[model samples]
Target: MRKRSIAAGLLTGVGSFVLATAAQAQASAPDTQSDGGAAANSQSEALTAEAGGDIVVTAQKRAERLQDVPVSITAFTGETLARAQIQSATEIARQAPNFRVSVLGNEDQPKFSIRGVSTSDFNLNTASPTGVFYDEVYVASQALGGSSLFDVERIEVLRGPQGTLFGKNTTGGAVSIITRAPSMAADVGGYLNLQAGNNDYFHADGALDVPLVQDRLGVRVAFTASTSKGWIDNVTGRDLSTISSNALRFSAKYQDDADFTATLRIGRSRSNPTNIGPIVNGFGPGGVSSTGVNPRINPLTGQPLGQRQGAYNVIGEIRAYGDNANLTLTKGLGDLTLTSITSVIKGQFLNTVDVDGTNLDALQINFADHSKEYSQDLRLSSDFSGPFDFTAGLYYFKDIADIDTDYFIAGHSFTLAQSYRQTRTSYAAYADATLEFAEGSTLYGGLRYTSDHGRLKRFEVVPTIALQPTLKYNDAKPSGRIGLRQKFTNDIMAYAQFSRGYRSSGFNGGALNSAADITVARPEFLNSYEAGIKSQLFDRKLTLNLSAFHYDYRDQQFINVVTVTSVGLVNAGRSKIDGLEAEVILRPAAGLSINAGLGLLDARYTQLVLNGVDLSGNRMIEAPKSTVNFGLDYTAPIGNGDIAFHVDGTAIGKVFFSAQNNQDQAGALFDLNARLSYKASAGWSVGLWAKNLTNNSVVTGAVSVDAISQFTTMPFPRRYGLEVGFAF
Candidate 1:
């Protein structure tokens, strides 16, 4: 309660201060400077380039300088990622402020939490509030979340509600991954890389770009393949956490002078990994354990016997495959530009797990799912070169999923099999406009109307149980944002905004016992108030950005422990989130760069009643109060090549994985990553990289069984590797 009060006070104070400052700026800059506006834009762009190496982002569905976007965003270019040795998407959380990820049994399925908002339910049918997009097309299922990051262009993490432009499932925020496209202007070129690491890990990837018709047509192909021996030794013969995955992508582009351009991309990936199963944590209510403290321990040390070992009678693994395609078309119509994006994706996933972490097979599960998705986005925007410009778009999305699950407990004495199909559909229309009424001052607002519908076909189970044959959920809402951006000077800018975001309703897809157990949760909504400042100082060598926000959250969808053995989806009556974020980048020397970020959050349930118990004031799960990240990059010439070294780390405060805020399910962890590389003038490079240098195997997620026992999953241990690459 005291923390909430303090956060509230801070929020109120910042809101008042920013409002006053904005008003003062408005009054001082009442007259329009027609000719200076262009120069100011150019100057701002130049400053951004100098400070951040010309980072560009599409946070607002349009290409713009990162510093010029009113929203808070963190962007990483391909070069930066390579230098940091950040391969998978989940690894990015360490460098992003207020961002975190939790794995579900395997590396292929990751749940993202941003700014205290996340999906707690592990059901495959549920969608995350933080939407993940590939080239602007939303991915609805974590089953298909393991997209390869090879040959990428840039990654943008947009904070705050993007409902005005991104539409539904963006109540928290959005992640946009823009991959490299075929360029006709580029000559036939390509690069190849091979890497080897501990744990018998090996990786090879390459990309080739070819111009078919000089300046008119081009094609690009990229491929990546990797395999690794399991780091976790299992007494049951097969090792856990072993990985084997490969992916390939093809891109083609056509351009008709400067009037029209079209690009098409198609990709496919397959992964078959031996996943880490759960470890038993204490006993549940009235649950008697015949096997005391599973996993025979080391009596001398009083710890688990092996450094990285598990006793599993049943091997666990995940087999997943996916295929996707997207096409983007753009046309120039004088001062207006029209664009269309169409995408389709198909995926299949099969998983088997030994849930008890013991050799007895006390609990085990086998699950499989198939997914198909399609999306279309059409938009038009104007480049008036005047004070006014606008963008309008129509978006449509559809997804269908089929699920099959089986559970075995008590040494297979009791077994259950279930199957079901689910579908989701959404449509949205939105418009955003900006007008510079006065010099260095802009007014921007956007509106979006969204309609969402969800359905569950039927619950089919062996040993037939009576339940609802079908279920449906529907909602229509309006979400948008209004903000004022004031450029106090060419290098400094401030903005304040009020926005609303929404998450669609969903049905429970977990184990069911009766008709009453079949349930649907109401849609969740968030109203946000935010203020921020962006600045570049000291001759454009230093960059600093800060923001504060408060959220009025309602009907937050959460997983409820219905019984000792079953769980379902429910809605929290009310909740609140208050946060402040800051990022800094400095180039103090010619050969060095420093970057740092900080995120503070105060999130709690203001009103929540479950099963007649007043559980108010409980801290939200997966939300850490404080997070900090810092890094250093240095480069210097040595002999015939240049040597580069980067080292970064992130410290995350205590995080709760259970809604009850159980201490047993909470922990804090830190991660360190470093890379050293030398590039020669002859188009060749060699590097060494390491991740999780401390080998901190912290529990990232948990599943409770009737509050009697819990199953916890841990992150990968330390990994070190060396790579060789050549360009031609």
Candidate 2:
């Protein structure tokens, strides 16, 4: 059935292309550029825009055309993000193939999975296997996870293992966010946008670029402030999903056309959002009550609440705040360019949940944490004209976090408090190079050596629990990549690669029942083999990329639920993942653009034995077997302005939130988005946008408590809004 659906989609795309071609016979060439950013560039922006010139990227720690990189990546330009109203990480995941995000009870923290690799444990101190880097600085804590999409320059999603260049915690893949730099172009330019929508949603974000000294020094300031009454209607009074957040970034850059450049950035963000309680499934392992009905009943219906509506006595809330600073310097010394990047981040997060989702106050949980991180990366890149070119770098990272959690159960009759401090330090060195062996054939490979150290101290549980001794862990691992590439032509390239990815070992921070629960989870490793081709055919009017990958995974980390109230990280014996991905972009006419992506995956555990249970062959959590996305955009000149319309839809296959893969613990999702806008030649625009047009909602993640009930988390329901913007 999935194959048939894919074929039908292709046929539909061809039909649309033929119709677009017929219409172009009577129209002149329309402006194909859809950029609305102050830092706009003339190139193919994203999957939703026309395929035109080259897109420059730094996927390999060096600037190169996207088409030239051998890795599988999906990138979005600032203009494309604005046009699509993609303001959150989950929204971006919806547009990318083979990528998924699961939001836990806390709305701000989202776990990312790429190519069937992910971490399911919701431990605040544990870093995600899929690393996220903001301007080359790694984000080290899940507590600091929030919206960071405003005033961005470009976003790159690299699939498969990127252990060589990215290093550490990237057994899955990497997400790189490159912010727009202060231009030294002797021009004062800026952009402002305002948006209003249903559920009392209001958003305002803008960026201003100022030239302090022409062609030398400049500054850029950007901010985003948004508030919403939220969508989830609560019977108890205030809306359940309300959100209020603000972020600001200030950047200063000094550059000499001769050889030196330095940039400094300081940013801060705060969010206080009222969380909607999870949808309550049927009774958990405890089974139904004597009445044969659910034990937890909804007051309105007198039945178990299986929907998203909330009826909480104590409203679930989260306060997440962060401050970050980064400094980068680059100097050219003959053929070698020396670069340095230093970053520091500080954050505090507090989360409270009405676990039972009832006015009865059966259960509640409070989680709070304070975290700080410091990192430095130094690199030397060569710009040699010779066949052999290389990039080498050294990296150091350290993070410290203090966690405090309180659990209230049985109508607040029993309470538990757990506190711990976790610290991690890592050091690494890596190098990569490419050599043109023959005319158009090249050999590229790199190796990275990493040393990781972890310490957990002052772990204690209140109410006369044992005082846990300080636990320490240290390990050294080597990971790398080797690939071969052939440039058949200027518009086509193919590559094959084998890469090794790694995730550091750490103590489970979620363990609170006893000292025995605080066990170390050994490092997980992956061996991936991949082959792909990239081509621009039909006179650059069509772009297609295809890749196939297989992974031999060992010691896969998974959450082991010992009981309702206790959980820890344990390594599954083994697993395997096979995947195929394809991306197509077509410019059927002057102002018509279409894009489609297909991802097919088969990921499952090959061997597993937990407590005398042979639980092998289970599908990996959030590892959907099939995914598809299609996008269409059309623009036509009307008088002195242009009217553009865009619509896109994504279909995600069924996914399980637990390793057990229960029938009721899985669901699928399909989302549709559309935007209609008019851009005047005077640099002002207005648009109408709608997301989740069908109001589709399904369970994306869930947790089952022993003797309790299953709690599920869902995506935002539906939203439609109007936006006004001006750029100069």
Candidate 3:
């Protein structure tokens, strides 16, 4: 059935191209001299009207107007990111709607999700549901997980499935990070930022951009350091605090603009001991301490219960180092243009943490992981006006990683190590063409053919038990999209599209225990149908976008609790999710803006049976039913300076934490930030800022374990600070 669908899609795509060509040939020929001048002027006008100045994006592997794209996307400029103080991917999560980011015990490992579809496993060998891309190159492993936001030009977040254009492993969505290119002009500028707040917190960041050669080469360097005192106290009278991190980044680029460009980047970061405070019972409902004792105790009685000092003992530390290099060559051949990108990246991380907190007795665990990735992509696109616009690309990726760990638990000590190597080679050919049937209406169709091959190996070791397993998987998926856009008026447009996406499967890292290990699962598939509208009102000052979508998911994979000896992860049954989303951006006046978004989701299991019991009506775990986000920002001119006020808030409705759909949790939180700045001169400024004015203690996440029947809660404390900066 899948093969037939692919064949039909290809036929339809080709037929559309043929019809468009015939129609173009029958129409009156355009005047080359006069029409060419008018077309150039129109393009210039369009670029001038872009949001934030003329910005170029490579969403389709070519520079194009963002407004002209048919997909729903959000683009953040470098200035905007700096104003919002977004330093990492985890911070970006707070601003995007229906998206969440989290880190496990290891700061070097990160998990990302969009619209409630995510992989929560912390294993080093598993693939993420959402894909991460840097300068069009994919990051291979979690060891290269968190990226520093230094000298970045822009970040594009494409919502929904992007399998048709981005290829495999992107069933949920994709994030693209575009770095700033070196400038040829001999100009130098830099910024220094210092922040200090409660909890003995301090942060400093600096950057310098310089032109190495006159209109030929350039270099940029950036560094960051931060430290904070712990808010939680330990019973052992030890200080559980975090030390400052030292991070440095350097970038060098050479460009002559003819046909070739080369760039190289190197970065190193080291983090001091990060304290994971003692587990306190009663913080959440039905919580108990690890030592099996009451959480709430009288400070003067009960043998002091531990010492209520503001610190815990040192647990572990992490250090990360990475290097990346890329070269791009572009040349025009007849009516077609060929472009090639070759890149290599290598990264290493070292993590050491104390598994258990104790004064006289201590338990510690150390982990070291490293990874290397190399890729090459070649693309050919046509610029000739032949009633067809198309692009084709070839991609190759290879990765190898190793992990070593030493575990110590009181009287027992053990060492375990594992290694993984994977080589994924994909060949994809995709093309999209638009048929101008009449004035203000067009038909668009696209098809993509992708072939992938992957191999994995795992080795486990113990004094008494040792096991090794090897697995290889291959798949060929063809995805297509057909859509129509009709311009009803000058300011209103409507669109409808049908698209398909797939996610490859691999080993389950969360199922690996010292005593038992389970087999891997297979890949999953998704089909989505969507329709939307875009409107501009009040003289283009207010914009509204609304979309509704339905998705059919098959062979959903999840972690299940079997018997104590056989607990592991597996591929579960199928499910369905349908939802609606709306976004509104209003610019009432100069220097003032309001943005709001809302999402409503309905997700449930369609066919799920376990242990002779039907589990069909269960709501998806950790998936919220509704979410809301709102923000207000205004900047006003003052005497020789400008003052800004901003407020943003997020609200998540009730959600179930478990598969049984019994536990319900909900919350709403608000964050307010304001700054008053005085411009000292042409290149310097000073500001006073305040954050979390409400000082509300909000819960961020919660989890419940079936083995112990205990729940754990994580909360974020309020913080406020002041800063000074300079720009030239």
State which candidate has the highest TM-score.
Answer: 1
Supply the global lDDT for candidate 1. 0.79
- Residues 1-728, model 3: lDDT tens digits: 34334333543454344334433422432211110001110110112123532244556555554434556656666765666666666556645666665454433455666666665454565667677887677786775656566666787776677776676667767787776655546788677888777778787888787898866688778888777765445554544534455677776766565644456656666655454443332333434334243444433355434322322244445666666776655565655667676778877766655433333223454656667788887777665554445666676766766665555544344443433444455666766556546665667766777776666555554442355566567777777677876654444455677877777656544433542454566777777776665555555466566666677877666555442123355555787777666667777888887878776667777888765777887876545677777767687877766766666666666555445554323255554544555555465666665555565434343333333322222333556677777877
**Candidates sorted by TM-score, descending order?**
1, 2, 3
Over 4 Å off, model 1: 1-52, 284-303, 562-564
The ten-residue window of minimal lDDT in model 2 covers: 35-44
In the range 84-195, model 1's lDDT, one tens digit per residue, is 8777777888888999888766767888888999878887888899999888889998877756678877788888888898888888899888788876665799899999
Candidate 2 per-residue lDDT over residues 1-728, each given as its tens digit? 35434544543465344334433422432333211111112111112222464566677887676777899998888877877888866677867899878887544687889988988887777878899888888998886754558888888899998999999899999988888888756689999999999888999999999999997899999999888885665666676767788899998988787778888899999888886666655563444422233535666777554355766676767888999999988888877888889999999988887666566667788989999999999988887777888889899999999999898977778988889899999999999998888976889999999999999999988863567788999989999999998866565677899999999997887776777888998999999988887766665677777887888999888787655468888898899888888888888799888889888888888888776788799887779998898888899999889999999999989988777787435566789999999999999999999999978887767877554466677677788999999999
What lDDT score belongs to each candidate, Candidate 1 first? 0.79, 0.79, 0.58
What number of backbone clashes does candidate 1 have, counting pairs of residues 3 or more apart or in separate chains? 2
TM-score of each: 0.92, 0.92, 0.83
Name the regions of candidate 2 deviating beyond 4 angstroms: 1-53, 284-297, 301-306
